[model samples]
Target: MSGLWDIRLEGSLETLSPFCVIAPGAEEVTRANGGKYRRISRRTLYRDGLRDSRPVVPGSTLRGRLRRSAVEVVRILSGERMPLAQWHQNAIGGIKGSDSEAAFDVQLRITLREKNPVLALFGAGSPWMTGRAAIGDAIPEGPVETDLIGGARSDDGRRDGMLFERLDADAAEQWHAMADANAARTRYKKAMRDLNATLRAARKGGGPEEVARLEAELADLVRCEEAAGLMSTNPVSMPLLHEAMPVGVRMRHRMMLTAVTEAEAGLFLAAMNHWMRSKPALGQHESLGYGLLRGEYDLWLSPAGAGDPFSVGQAQALPLGTMTAEPIAGLSGVPERLAGFMAAFREAFRSGAFDFRLASEIG
Candidate 1:
């Protein structure tokens, strides 16, 4: 109850299907034994004064669900060495990673589910901090004590929202950097595949002379990959792009305090897929869901030999260790009073926290 607050995220829903639930039905099938979602509709405004909170959802809740889904989807889609080419050979285009019409769209849906709500919450200045981050360092010593009867003041003179502001600022910076890098990798990989396909086609001329020419061309491609530093010994290779930290992007933020589980990620993915399949018109925004997944996949990496393919099943099967709560106070250097409030919420999350049901809005 100390951490609970009335926070609403502002974002659009690509789908209008009521049957489409963003969260899975069962707790065992999900991270928190349930999924969280805000029923976004087309009517949600980009910039309007105090829209109805009836359909709104909390950004933190959505983030938790989306983060879980993205990781699981990634494991299913790109975790294995299986290629779209192999699927093509079998004419089975419905598989997750297969380069079929739905593959990119499915991935995109996950990205949208993850990013839109987050962007909306931050852009609208929600009164919630990220799992990391804190208020500024302008407060007193130790954690601020909250009286059971008479509510005590935050460490800093300002309210709890100030802490949320600071945390969002820090998270925004890191989120952008990681996203840009992943985008770059996706683009570079596409280019390499196209170049290789062209060379392979040229080699089908079937003469010694043609074979020699194709081999020379192939050699050049190898050199190019080497020069780009995309040819790594690591099985899951990535380009060695020399990216300077984007201007205005801060990198000194503290690490995540709330560790998300894999079940949560899967539920998020299911919700996103349901949303995207129901609404195909909003393309690029939908694609950002996968980008968000690409951002958080590290949180729930599946162990080797958990299954034939590394996936959410692997992560879910891993014995859940003890959940720990850290002092969320000092990370962001925000006001002490504000820092404590932010920290407490995140600490609870680290210790497997959730909000209980209040009055239902359904008529």
Candidate 2:
């Protein structure tokens, strides 16, 4: 039931924790760092001339993440037999023919491989035609502000786990030193006061000058104590940290399609459903509980205004609006073909034809 329809997905990408989706160019960076990150909040460039005041999640990033997530659904449906190498072979058709699990029937497409439905959906290989799926970058719908969080640093030095360790050590030592020295400090202050009093009463030469010097020293000690107290309260948590993207920013991705069938649309939405339903995160600091997002998906059979539009929502929440009339959904010959493709793909995934890769296994 598709014909000249566009899919406009509107919903808030509610972040469970602070998440960041920053690129090298516009990210707030440290001086001499070459690439910017943190240091300050700045607008992020989604593409040339499309800069957002807050960092926006890139569509490519989301697509990659969703694709990887779909691997998990494939794995669970297949029970853990599929590994990364084999799984990609099935999805992209790198392996030989007998692989019934291969998503793209490369052997079948030798005549017009570019016309392969799955490859055509994701724009395989390039140089022929644009991808059928028109996924767009997600931007915050409301005000977004940055926050700093210590994330376990990566092997590449994006964040250093030891940074927190060292800070903790220093804080502990300083706190202990201050606690132990508190009595001594009090005694020293009292003695200085007594000496100054005695000198004042004696009216002796050099007494005022010596007392003044002692007073200055006492003032310095007081400053040290204050500093130690503040440092002791210093956050001695994780070491690796960065300026994180603001959480709670609403987002929407308007995916417009020129002509796509039910199977293609179903497979695409099903994969995305796995992403939204699952708790895997997007962007950086995933371990530190950042990038976790929850959203809804809505499919429109046609652009609004072309008589009432037929639509379906993943959940009760529906993000609706008028989109361009250039794109449309195909109604004929989609389900049967796409269903067969999906079944084989799932079978291959489940039968270990495609080895699924988890985030933990990623380098």
Candidate 3:
């Protein structure tokens, strides 16, 4: 349990439609007075002594949101009750206590530092699961222009489905490819069957002339089969139906995580992959169709005591050496120490063992 990684995610994003991140504004906020919310970017000014990039989505928010998404995945996989939002902040914001009737004061206070996989990956027993991973604020690669619209509501629950049924991004392309391949396969089989039937009838019935005609027809069918095979090899590509996208949109993101076990690290990677593939995040105001991006992450793993782990020089898609945690002896008493660390392991990973559900989560 030593080799931990500093993972970096780089990608570009374009919305399927005009959307907003929902910056705060007054009740009477209007477009003219600057009271209306607009898109933002990570920037800074020299006016402040030591400047810091005021991010469109800060490191804290990025980490927390991703962490929450990860936790949700872990929760489903592990069957733990990791809430999605909080005072207790989760990316799926706006939480009023859970379905539990018990008041906050009556909630149990015994913080058990078990060697639970989720807790070890993301922190638990606190309002925030500041997990093992730390994601930096996404810096913009281009301008983040905003557009105004009305009738924004949260009733449109299935944004991902809408993405396939609507826009033609990578996700939509995937769906279309599957459908077309199935149809092409069906058509090819029917043509082959017709050719065989014609050949059988000609052989059973006629003379040389008729047999020659059937053979010629069979040759035509063979050509059709060849064409079908070619089509199968290279299906007609659909142009991305992205009339909703605007110009100059992309961002770069970086993240680092420490994992004592393979499961922990894999969990983090899985969560990020699912989130991006789903295009769930770009910023806030998702209900109005804001924040959907595509990307893949690169990883660099180093031993725990590596001199300069922060300096990620030439990290690849996987870890350098495989690291595995030695099995624990028992689970009787409390007094956590690395005896079964569910604490001290960052905020993201500290809940339960990973039980990922690919169909519902990733697929």
Candidate 4:
């Protein structure tokens, strides 16, 4: 019971639409066409005694998607607007800086683990906790076919005098209002930047009175900006291009869960189930109908012995395909053992056995 439980999820992720996973600053701006195009993420791989680089869905992207979906599930289940103070600290991790206390407090760490299953499974950085879940890069089984998709935005019609003449007076007035709003937003951004710089300087060397004044000014500026509204206006036509993997491209994805309890596993699986049912889009251009994926996976469990933790015993296959009702409460057509785990998670959540406080509260 004290030993680790190794859970493996092997799946095929097939793209239902053109998918693009672009790393930041990875886009290529073409001068010839005055267009911006981003390629899908790629990594070097050895295949058939040859080294080649091809488009790949990064493991980090998959992990991020899963973490986001899991957090959303928790939010819906708990009915909290802001579940954790720092989602990064709870779902991902945060490093303790030199000024912070060392993560050597074993009792505190154990308490955090017992309180929050998410922190226990995903880990936190306040005490340098290690995550139990790991996802491998989704590698294409065959050649990945990619194509360029082009999109364009219509002009804002402000510069076209003829078009404005044909429009009604009210429409013309609305256009002017949009232009004014754009100018106001620009001014607000500049003022905010200047205030931020002054505040930083005050905090560093200026007197406390100056710092307080700057803070108050900053708060007032924020309120004004909110009242004025924050929306893009007077948008000009621009060409957008994306180099994406075409639909029906199948990639192999694997997720490994280490040292997870039955309840913890159930919670994680429930999140996955939610993600699958919701059909949440991944990667970029979700608004443009990109990044839709269909996942079909098989689950396996292995219990390690205390004498040799690394040694995995016979793995039991749990062939629960993508079919689940509620997050953890309505799992139907699953194994009795798996259902028990789901029941345990449901009871734990219902009884408030786990603390759902803001992550900042955790020492």
Q: What tens-digit string does per-residue lDDT give for candidate 3 at 1-363?
A: 334444333333334434233334412333432223333444563444775543344566555555665656655554556433332423332233344433322222112112333444455433223356566655556444443444322222133446555544576657566656756765775676776777788788868898898788878867876776644464333211111224235556666665445445555545554455443545555664555544333334444444455655454234332211111211122222222323323333444222222111211
Provide the TM-score for each candidate, comma-separated.
0.17, 0.47, 0.43, 0.70
After the best TM-score superposition of candidate 4, give how far the Cα of residue 244 lies from its true spot, in angstroms: 1.4
lDDT for predicted candidate 4 compared with the true structure = 0.70
* lDDT winner, 3 or 4: 4
lDDT of 1 by residue, 204-239 (tens): 646677767767866786677678564442322222
Model 3: how far residue 265 lies from native, Å: 0.7
Each prediction's whole-model lDDT (CA) = 0.30, 0.50, 0.45, 0.70
Q: Which residue pairs come into collision in candidate 4?
A: none
lDDT of 1 at 258: 23
Off by over 4 Å in 2: 1-6, 24-28, 31-52, 71-118, 126-129, 150-239, 303-363
Mark the 10 consecutive residues where model 4 has the least summed lDDT: 323-332
Candidate 3 colliding pairs, count: 22
| lDDT for each residue of candidate 2 in 143-184, tens digit (9 for 90 to 100) | 467775544323222245454455654665565555455445
lDDT of 3: 0.45
Candidate 3 deviant stretches above 4 angstroms: 1-19, 23-42, 45-55, 78-114, 117-130, 149-248, 277-288, 308-363
Poorest lDDT segment (10 consecutive residues) of candidate 1: 242-251
Q: How many backbone clashes does candidate 4 have?
A: 0
Q: Mind giving the per-residue lDDT tens digits that candidate 4 earns over 238-305?
A: 45567988888888888888877776777776776666567457788888788777666666666633
